[model samples]
Target chain A: MKDSKKQYIRGEINKTGQSSSVGLIIRQKEPNNLETPFDQVDSFLTPMELFYIRSHFPTPKLELASYQLHVDGAVRNPLSLSYNELRDMPSETRVATLECAGNSRVFLIPQAEGAQWELGAVGNAEWTGVPLGALLERAGIEEHACEVVFEGADRGTPKELPIPPGPISYARSLPRDKAMQQEVLIAYQMNGHDLPQDHGYPVRAIVPGHYGMASVKWLTRIYTVREPFRGYWQTSDYGYWDYLDGKPVRRALAEMKLKSEIARPRVYETLAPNQAHTVFGAAWAGETEVTEVAVSIDGGQTWAQAEFLDPIQRHAWRRWKFDWLTPKKPGQYILLARAKDANGNVQPDQHDQNYGSYVINHPLPIEVFVDDLGRPGR
Target chain B: MKDSKKQYIRGEINKTGQSSSVGLIIRQKEPNNLETPFDQVDSFLTPMELFYIRSHFPTPKLELASYQLHVDGAVRNPLSLSYNELRDMPSETRVATLECAGNSRVFLIPQAEGAQWELGAVGNAEWTGVPLGALLERAGIEEHACEVVFEGADRGTPKELPIPPGPISYARSLPRDKAMQQEVLIAYQMNGHDLPQDHGYPVRAIVPGHYGMASVKWLTRIYTVREPFRGYWQTSDYGYWDYLDGKPVRRALAEMKLKSEIARPRVYETLAPNQAHTVFGAAWAGETEVTEVAVSIDGGQTWAQAEFLDPIQRHAWRRWKFDWLTPKKPGQYILLARAKDANGNVQPDQHDQNYGSYVINHPLPIEVFVDDLGRPGR
Candidate 1:
C-alpha cells in the first residue's frame, strides 16, 4: 500500500500563536512533526512515521555512545549514568496514548495562541522503557524535594514573541507525586524499535495519561527541586486559566480530557442512501478508561451504543465501530461520536474556554451529504 | 418530493437551559419549531416548510381582521393600525437570512443549556412587509425615547426556572436606531404568501441584520421606552457576558457574526477517491455580504478559493461551489469550508467561548472517509 504523501507537522517555534498558522506553514526544516493519517488508521498502534511529532525546538543531534543521563539536584546522591548502563537496567513495556496539550486547538474558535493542531496530534503506541520511579529509587530523592524537572538537549530562542525570552533548552517539571508514579517511564524504544531521531533518539520520557509535552523528549538531565518548578513551559505556556482561592491563575495542564473523533466517513465524503454502513472511530480518556462510546446519526438528537473493536487497555485508545442503517431518503445528515469515561466524564458538547485551546475534547460535528446515487463504502 | 419527516423545534418555556435538553426532546406538542431539511436545499431561498421555527410560548390565536398593531409609548402620536390598514400603506420585499442566535447550539461543547438545534435553525427567505421606519416615522418618536420594545401576544408562565419569573409574554427590545432602519419590517406576508401560524402569524417584526429574537412574532404592541428594556429575554437571557466600562455586564446581542457551513457531504457520507467532485455549501454575514469563500482539503494546511454560485446579495446567504479533484489514494480526508465577509470578518478556526452559546460561528469539522469502492454522487 502506498503512503498518502503523509504529513508530519513539526512545530519550529515556541512563540508562534496558533492563529498565525491558520493557512500558512511557518517553516520547512527538520525536527519532524507528523499526524497519523487518520483515514489509513485501521489498526490500534500508530505507524511510526504517522505518529505526530511536536517539537519545541530543532531535533537535537545526539550520539548515543557519548550520551550520559545526569541525575542531580535535590537527591541524596547525585549520579550520572552512561546510556548503556541505563539501558542495561530493568525495563518494562506498555501500550499508551500521548496527545499534545494543544492537540485539537484548531477547534478552539478565535484561535488561541499556540500550535494549531487538528485531531491528529494524538496516537496510541507500545513503548519499552525503565520506569522513572525506579531511577528515583536508585538516586534516593531528598524528602524536601517537591518537583521533578526534565531538561532536554534541544535549545533555542523563541523568535515570534514580542520579547524573545529563550536561549534556553526545552524543559518541564512534574509534581513529586506525578514523577513518583510507577507508570512514568524513561523510554528508550518505541514500538520495539530504537527511538528515531525526531522522537528522542536514544532515550525519552514517557509520561502516560498526560499530554505529550509532559513526556519530555531528547532527555539530558533530571533535577529534583525543593520548591515548585517555575520553568517557562510550566508557568507561561501549557497551562489553562483557573480561579483558585478566588484568584485567577494558570493551572498547569496535566491529564488528558476524554475525547472521541469520527475518523471514518472522512469529512466531505459522499455516501449512498439506504444501506448499512460500518461507521468507525476512536475514543480515549487519560487515566480513566472510556466506559461507553455512542454514535449520533441525527445531529445528536439520538445516540446509540458502539461496540468496542479492540481489547480494553488502561492508557491506550479504544477503537469502536457502529453499524448504521442509512436513512432511505437521500439528503444531508450529521454524524457525531461521543464517549463517556468510567468517571462519568462524558465528552462535552461545547468548548469550555477555561481550557483555552488545550484539552479540546469536544465532540465536533461531522457533516456529510447522503446522495441516492452515491457509491457504496468498503 | 417527500417532506422527510420535517422537523421544527419550538420551545415551550423560556427557563429551559440549553444543556438540560441534551438527548431528550422536552415536549412533543408545539407552537412548532421546524428545521429546513438542508439536504433538499437546492435553490438559494429556503422553502417555507423547511424553514426553522422557534417559539417561547404557544402560537397566539390571532384573527387577521381583528389584529391591530398598537404603536404607543414614547411616541407623540399613539396609534393602532389594523392588518389591512398597514398592508394598504406600502410594501417592500427583501431576501434576508435570519439565524436563531442559538441555531447551532448542538455544536457548542459542554452542551449549552436550551434546545439542541443543529445547523437547520437558519434559513434565507424573501420576507414581505412594510418598513418599520415608516411606521416609527408616522408615530413620531419623542426625543427622550432611547429604546423601542416589541411585544408579542404569546404568553405563559415559564415552567423550568428555579425562580419562575413569568406568566409573561414573549417580548424583546431593539435600540432606537435599529428600530428606525428602513430595512426593519412589520411583515404580514412571507414569500408572497400570508404569514404561517408557526411563524409570527398575522404580523411579525423582521429586524434585518439581528438575530431571530429581535424579530418578534405576532406583533401586538410596539413601545418606544425612555429606559432600556429590562425584560426577561433582554437582561436575564439572550445576553452575552461583556465587560463594559471596566464592569462585567450582559451585553445585548445584536448583528449576526460572519459564518459559513459546508452543507453538502453531510457527515459520514462516504465517497470514491481520485475523481473530480463539486463541493458545495452556504455562507452568510448579517447585514454584510460574504466577499470570498475557501476550501481546505488538508486539515487547514492550505486553502483554495471557491466560486460563488448565485448572485451576491447582502443579508442573504451566498451559495458556493468548488471543483475538487479528490485525492487519488483513498484514505480519509477532511474537507473544511471557510468564509470571509466584506468587513474582513472571517470564519474562525476555533470557538470563542466569550460569546458563550449564543454566537456559535466557529467552523465545525466534518469528518468523511474516502473509500475506493464508494459509489458516485449525483
Candidate 2:
C-alpha cells in the first residue's frame, strides 16, 4: 500500500495473514508475539480482544477434567455433560452478536450507574456448539417448567448481604421457549479456537440477540424452573433502576435497543482539500435485522442511504458504507450515521426513559475536515 | 458500625490501611482498596497507582542516576537538575486536579468522533515540587518567548504523521499568567513520597486546571518557544473536531467546565423499605471554586441544597453530600446531583458541540432504590 494520504483504508490481508485494517485500541496489553486472527468483521464480528469481556470475577483457570455441565431441577431426567461430551454433540454454528447491556455506556451523558465501558462492549462471533434445544430435550425438561437458569463457574469477591447469604456471582433466567431458541448454544469454541480465558473457556452459552449477561460465561450449571429466577446477576443487579422520587426502582430486563458505531474516518484524521472518501461502520439489533443505514454529512438534517451488508439472520449486524465526496468549502463537518431495523424503527437522537445505560438508537457523529489545499491559485 | 441491611457495607480495612468500597471503579491492574486519607487531589496528582499515566511510546525503565531535568531554550542559564538537586529546591505542595480534555466523554452520545473514555481520564492528587516559573526565573526567560514547551521521558510508537516527530510523549503550554502561577510546580514528590515509576518518578509538572496531557509524566525537558509549539500532543491530535458539512474542523483547547461524579448510590443497589441515607459525591471545575451542590429527587422538578465541604481552590474538587430521607412510597427514584461553580456555571443537562472530547458538565443521575416492605395482609 502506498504511504501517501489516501481516501480510505479497507481491511485487507497482510503479510502475517491477519487483516491490515484491524486497529488495536490499546497497544499496552497485546500478547508478546502472538497475533490473533479475526474473520472479516464486515460490521458484525468483533475481534475477540476487542469484544467486550465482562467478568464477575477475574478469568479463572479451569481444567476440562473438573469442568462439568450439570442439569437438574424441574427436569424429568437430570443430565450432566463433561466438556468432551458437550463438544462432541452435533455442533451447530450461527453468526450472532452478544452485547453488554451497558455497551457504549460512557456515551451516557449525565453519568448513569454502572461500569464505564468505553464503546467496545459488543462483538459478533461465529459460535459452534450444541443446540440449546437439543440439550434441553436430552435433559428431559419437565412439561411444567417455565424458565431455565444458566450458571457460571466464577465466584466473585463477595460483598455483604442479609443474614444467611450475600451477593454471589451468578446469573439466572426465563421461559423455556426463549431458552430453547435454535440460536442459543452451549459452546466451547469462539470464532475457531478454544475460548480465551477472558471469554469463558471450557464452555458458555451463546444466546443470540440478547445482552452478554444473558450468555452466562464459564458455564457450570443449568436448571429448569417453574417460576422466574431472581439471582444476583438478574434481580438485584444488572437490572435497571429508575431514579423517581429520588430513589432507584428495579425494572425488568428488556430486549436491547438498536445501536451502531463508525470504525473508519476515526475522529481527527486530516483530509486533503475537497477530498472524497467512503465511510464504513456497523450496526446491530437484539432480535431485529438492520434494514438500512443512513449517513448524514450535515449532522442529522439530511441523510443519504448507505449500503448495508445483508445479515445472515435477524440477529446479526449489518455493515454499511457511505461514499462521501470532498466538501466544496474548507471547514469542519459532522458525519452522522443512523441505522434503521426491518421493523421500521429509526434510530432516535436519544432513547425513552427506561434508558438506564441500556438501549439507544442515537445516531453517531464523526467530525472530519476539508483543508484549503490552495492549489497554485486554483 | 452496625451491620445493617440498609446501608452499603464497605469491606474491612486491610493491613495496608486501605479500605475497599463496594463500587470503586478500579482497573484490574490496580489495588482494590479505595481510601482517600488526603482531602484534596491535585490536577496531576494521581495516586502512584491511579495517577493519570500517559505513555505515547513504550514505558522506559530509567535508572535514578541517569535521569535529569534539562532546562534549555532561549534562556541565559541553560541548567540541568539531577533528581537530588531538584529535590533540594524549596518544595512547594498544592492539591490540583488534572482532567484529560476527554474526561466525562461518554456523555457525548450520538457517538462523537474520537477515543471513548467514560470518565476514567480524570484524577486528583497532592503534588509537591519547585515552581516552573521560579525555575524559568533562574534560567532567565527570553523576552520574545511566547510559549513554554515541556516534554516527557517517553518516545511514542510510530504511526502515520505530520504526526509530529515522536518519541513524542506529553507536551503543553500556557499563556503567561498560567505559566507564572506560584502554584504551577515542577513536581517531584507525590503525597510525601518520591514520585513512583508510573508517575514520572524524578519530575513532572503539576499545572493546575489544565488537562492531564499538559502535565507530562516522566518529564525531561522544558523549552521556551517564540511561536506555539508544533507538537502532536499540542495539535493534529487532542484538539476538538467539528463536523462542518461532514468534514472535521479542529477546535481549540479551553478551560474545563464544572462536572461531578457520584461516589456512592451505585447503579443497582437495593434499598430495604424506608431506609434513610446520605448521597455523597465530589464536584470540580477549572478557574473556579465549587460553591454549591444541588440534588434533584424528581428528575429536574425541585432541587434541594446539598452540604458542601470546605471549598478547595480554583482547580480542586469540593466534596458534597446530600441527605435523602426514605420515601413513604415504595418504588424507583432517580437521584440527580448538580453542582454550581463559584463562577455560577451550573452543571448542564447537555453540553455543546464536542470536536475531540472536551470539558463535560452534565448532571450525574444516581439511581437509588426504596424497596417496598411486604405488607402484613399479603
Candidate 3:
C-alpha cells in the first residue's frame, strides 16, 4: 500500500468513522483486519459495519467504470465483463456465514501465531450476487478443468513470507465440484447495501459454508485451471498442519466445523443468586443445519437443551437461548454451550489442534460469579 | 447495576453502536470496560466515542430532570444543583488527557491482575464545565477542610474484591490544593457534545493531568471533608504496592507519569526499504509539559529527536512525528519512542513498577519488517 493511499484511507476513516457503529474492534490497520464482539452478534444478519474483515493486502482503489472481471484459462471463451455488465446478469441472494480459518486462534491453550482473534472473526450476512456456476457456464469450462481459481486485485509481497520475493495477488482455489455449486456467488452487495470498500467493493466471491479465505475479496479474475491451483494462499497459508501417528498431515481449510458460543453472561460476569437469567448465544455449522444446542452451567457436568430462535436460515447461524436459574449457593461457575449439527458433528469439549489453530470449535468455558447481593437486576 | 438497566443500556448500545467508530476495543462487558487502539488516538482531542472507559460498575441510569449533585461537608453553604441548574452556571472548557492508571498493564512482563490494557487506555478530550475552584468558591469551603471527595452514582459489590463483601460507591479524593485547581472540572460536556451515557452523561468529574480514576464518572456527590478520604479506590485498589529501601511503600496514585506511544507503523508492519516513512505518535505528561520526544530505530542504541506538531494544548497530549528513511539492507527493525517532561522526568526504557501497573511510561519496542524488493508506496 502506498503512503498516499494510506493517508487517503485514514482521512476517510477519520471523517466517516467507518465501522464506528458496528461494534467491531480493529485487530490490524494496514491490511485492515477487524472482528466483532461475540455478544454483539444478536441478529441473524450481521450489520455491515460489524462484519469481520480479513484482508491479505490493503483495500485496492478501483473505479467501477473501469473495473473489469476477467474469466479465462481452460475455457472456450475468455470474457472480461465490466461491473455494470456483470451486475446486469442473473443475480441471486443468499444468507451465509463467513468465518476466518483462524477465528479462535487466541483461544488455543498454547497460543498460536497470527491474528490473536477470540470468537468475533465470524459473521452472517445476506450476500447478493451472480452465481459462479452461472459465470462458469457462460465461459464454457473445458472437460479437463479440475479447479477454479479466484484472484483479488489487492496485491503485495507479504513481508516475512518465505516465498521468493515478488508481488502476489491474493488468490485461492476451489475444486471443480464446489466451484459449480449454486451457492457460490460473485457478490457485489452485502446485506442490503453496495459492498463497502473493506468488504470488497465492485465485486467479490462469496463461497457459502466455506472459510472466508475461499471467498476472495476485491476480486478481479477467475481462472479455470486444469490442475489444482498451487497458489501461496493454498500451499503455505490457510492449510492446517498437524501430526497423526508421528506423521505430518496437511489439510486445506474449507468448511467451518460445528461451533457454539455463549454471547450473554460474558466472562467474569456476576450473576444474581436464585434469579432467572436468560442465556443467549449463537450456533453454526458448515453445509449442515444445526439440529440442537446444549447448555452446561456446571463445568459441563450435565447438559440441558436450549431453545433455538425462529426463522433459522440455511447457511446462516441459529440463535439459541436458555433460561438459567442460578444455584442457591453463590460462587464461581463455569458455563459452556455446544451445538450438534445434522451431519452428526458435535462441538468438541477441548481443542487439540496444533497447526495455525484452524477449525478450533472447542466449547469455551465462560466463568461467571454468582453473588446474592453483588448487584440488583441479574 | 440491575439486569433490566443492563438490558436497557445494551439496547441503547445496540441501537447506536456506541463504540463502533471510536476504535476502542471492549476489554470487559459487564462493568463496561473499553480501551482505545493506540493508533486510533490520532487527534489531540479524541472523539468522545473513542475515549477509554473504566467503569467499576454498570453505568447508573439517571434522568437529567431529577439528577442532583450534592455539595456539603466542610462548606459554609451546602449546594445541591440539578443538571440544568449546573449547566446554567458559568462554564469553561479545557483540553485534558485522561489515562487509566493501568494503561499498559498488558505489556507488564510477568503479567498483572485486572484488565490487560494496551496503549489505548488513554485519550485527550475537551471537557466543558464549571471549574471545581469556582464551585468551591461559591460554596465557601471551610478553613479546616483538607480533602475533597468525589462520589459517583454507580455502585455495586465488586466481584472478588479482597475487602469484605458489600456494596460500595466508586469514590476518590483530592488534596485541598489539587481540588481547587482551575483545571479540575465538574464536566457535563465532552468534545462539544453532551457526554454520552457510558462517558458519564449528565455530569462527571474531570481532573486534568490526573489519572482517570480521579475523574469519577456518573458523579453524584462532592464533600469537603476535614480529613483525608479513606475509600477503597484510594487506599486499597489504586494504590501502588512496591518495595522501597527494603520496605513496602504503598503510595496513592495521583498524576500520570511522562509517557509516549507510537501510534503508526503497528507491530510487525512491513516497510519498503529506501522509502521515507513518517512515524506518528503522541506524548503526554502529568502536571508537567512534555519537553521533547525521541525516536530510536535501531533498538534504542541510536536516537533521533522527533518533530512536535502545532497547537500543543495544555493538559492535553502532544502529537509527534519522525521522518524515518529505511536502511537499504532489509531485515527487521525495532522502533522505540520516549518522552521527557519539564519536571526532569523521562520515560523509562523498562517497566519495573509492580502494583496495579500505574504510571508505566516504559518505551515499548515495536518490531517492523523491512523488505528490499517489497511493494512500493510504503
Candidate 4:
C-alpha cells in the first residue's frame, strides 16, 4: 500500500466516528480489527459502534454506486446483481450474536498466536437483509453441490502459515445444510443503518449461530462447490487441534459453544457492604436455547437461580440478573456464575488447554471487596 | 419543553454520533440522562460518547456562533468571553475521572429513588481547556467570597424535589480552595474533540478528582457567593443522611471515594480449564493515590498482587492485570479484587446502605462457568 493510499484508508476508517459511539479495542490497524468491551452489552441490540470488527485485510475502497455481488458455480443459473438489485429483493431481519472463534483466546493457559481477545470479540445485533437461501434458490442449486463458499473483496497475505504463498482474498465455506438455513443472510444493514465500512460496506454475510469467520465481510462473490471447500480459514486457521485417543486430531469450527459472560461487576469490582445489588450478565448458545443460569456468591459453595429479561429471541443472547444482598461483615469475596442450555450442556468449571485457544468456555471467577463503611464519607 | 423543541433537542443528542461511538445507556430522553456501562473502561481515556451525561432538565439549544460565557462576582473585573476568545487563551490538558455521586444507586439495598445505575455511571477522559485558576486569577478574587457557583443552561422542574417548587436551572457550588485549584478547568474539548452536546457543547467545567456533580455541564454562568450555595442539588439531592453518635447528621457529596472495578471477566463469564487467563480491572481514588491492589481467586482465601499498566496519572484510573492459572480440576470458582490508596484507605469489605447509593466502593463479585470439555468438539 502506498503512503497516500494508506493515509486515505486511514481517513475513511476515522469517518466511522460519525456513525457509532461505542468504544472499540483496536487489535490491528491494517486489517481494521476491533473488538467490543463486555459491559457495552447492556442493550439487547448491540449498537453499531459496539459491534466487533474482523477483517482479513484493509477495508476495500468500493464505490457504493457501482458495488456488485456475483453469485455463480454448481447451479443451473449464475446471477450477478448490483447493490440496488439485492436490496430490492424480499428482506428479513433477525437478532443474532456473532462471536469470533477466538473470542477468548487470551484466556488460554499457553497464550495462542492469534488475536489475544478477551470478552469483547463478540456482539449481538439486529441484522436486516435478504436471506442467502433466497439468493441460492434464485440461482437454483445443483444436486451435486456439497458446500457454499463466500469470498470477500479485501485481499492480503495472512501472517500465519501452511497456506497459499501469495496474496489471497478472505474466504470461508459452509456446508450445504448450514448454507440453506433460513437465517443465513446477505446483510446490507446493521442495527438499522447501512453497514459501516469496518463491518463491510454495502454488503456482508450473516451466518446466524455460527462464528464470525463464516460471515465474510466486504462480500463480493458467492459460489458452490461439488466437494467440501478447503479454504485456509476453514481447515487451518479456525479449526481446533487436540489429542484424542493419544493421537492428534483436527476438527473444523462451526456453531459457537454454549457460553455465558458477566457484562457488569467486571473483574475486581468493589461492592457495597450490607447493600442490595443486582448481579447481571448475558448467556448464549449455538443452535440451542439457554434454559437456566445460576450464581454463586460464596465462592461456588451455594447456588441460586437467575431471572431472565424480556424479549428473549432465538439466535440471540438472553440477559439474566440476580438480586444479591451483601453480608454485614466486611471482607473480600469471590463470585461465580454458570449457564445451562436446552441441549443439556452446562458451562463447565474449566477448559482443557489448546494451542490456538479456540472456543474457551470455563467458569470465570471475579473477586470484589466490600468496604467496611456503610455510608459515604471523606 | 414543547414537543417541537423536544424533537429538536433529540436531534442534537443524536448528532453526538459524529463525535463519539461509545455506547451510552440512556436513562431518560427529556432530561437527557445517560450512563456509561462499566466494561467500556478498557482504556484510560474514556471516549466522549461513553462519558456519563447527567442533566436535571432538557438540553438548552445554543448556537455556537453566538455563545458566550460570563464570569462575575468576587472578582476585580467581571468578564464575558466568547468561545473563540477562551480557546485563544493559554490552555492545559488533564486526564480526570468523573463519577456521578449516585453512580451505583441501583445497587442500594432499599432501592434508591433515582436513576438506577449499576457500575456504568463513571468514566475518565482527557479534557482540554483553560484552567479555572488562570481565568480566576485574571479576574482577581474578592475576600468576602467563600464559594464559587456554576450554573448550567438547562432548566426545568425536577421531579419529586422538596425545594423550589417551580422551574429552576441546575446549579452547584464549590469551596473557594477547590475553585482555586490549578487542575480545575473550564473545558471545551473531550478526548481531543469538541465537546459533544450531551457533554456540554462549547464548554463545561472539569473538576479533577471530584464527583461529576461538581463538574457542571452546559455551563453558562460562574460567580462566587459569601456563603455555601443551598440549591437543591447542593444540599438535598447529592447528600447523605447518617446517624452520628445516635444523632442525625447530613453531609454533602464531594470527592469520589476510593474505588475499584473489574473491566474483564464480567459478572458471569466462562473460563477455559487448564488455561492461563489474565485477570484485569481498573482502580481509582479520591485525592489520594492508589498504593496497592489485591486479587482473590479463591473467595478471598488467597490474595495476589496485580501489576499496574504504564502512565498512571493523578486524578485518573490505573489499570491492573493479574495472570491467573486455572486448576486442572475444574468445577466452579469465585473471583475478587480490592485496592488500598496512599492515605491508608484500604477498600472495606462492605458498606452501610445509603438512600442515594452514592459513593459505593464495595468489591464487585463476578461469577463464571467452566465447561467439562477440555478441548473443542465437532
Best-matching candidate per lDDT: 3
lDDT of each: 0.75, 0.64, 0.79, 0.75
Q: Which residue pairs of candidate 3 clash?
A: A20-B20, A20-B21, A377-B3
Question: What is the per-residue lDDT of model 1 for residues A1-378, given as tens digits with 9 covering 90 to 100?
Answer: 123122222222111223122221222234455565454455577756667788878888899889999888889888798899999999999889999878777767788666667667888888898898888878989999888888889887643211113277777788899899878999998877888787898889998898898989989888888855544464345655454222133456888889888876767776778777778778889989998999998899999999988767888999888888888777888899999999888898988765656788888777887886645443
Q: What is the C-alpha lDDT profile of model 4 across A1-378, one tens digit per residue?
A: 233222222111121234334579888776778888775456666677777888778789778788889888888899999999999999999989999888877767657677888788888888899999899989998999988888888887765422333567888888999899989999998877789888988899999899888899889889887755545565346755443222223345789878887666667777677878777778888788889889888888999998887345789988888888977677888877798988788987777543256787676676787775546611
User: Residue B131, candidate 1: how far off, in angstroms?
Assistant: 67
Which portions of model 1 show Cα errors greater than 4 Å?
A1-31, A159-164, A374-378, B1-378
State the lDDT at B303 in candidate 4: 90
Q: Write the per-residue lDDT of candidate 2 for residues A1-378, one digit (tens) a residue.
A: 132112122244211334345553431232211112222344245555545566666566779998789887788888888888888889988888777776666567777555555445667777889988888899899998888888777765333110113224455575688888888888887766678787888888888887777888888888887755544444334545342222222343646678777656656555555556767777887888777788888878898988865543767777777777868687888887887777999788874444445664577566777676555321
Chain B of candidate 4 achieves a TM-score of: 0.88
Give candidate 2's error at residue A17 in angstroms: 12
Better of 2 and 3 by TM-score: 3
Q: What is the DockQ of candidate 1?
A: 0.01
Total residue pair clashes for candidate 1: 53
Estimate the TM-score for candidate 3: 0.47
Error of 1 at A245 (Å): 2.8
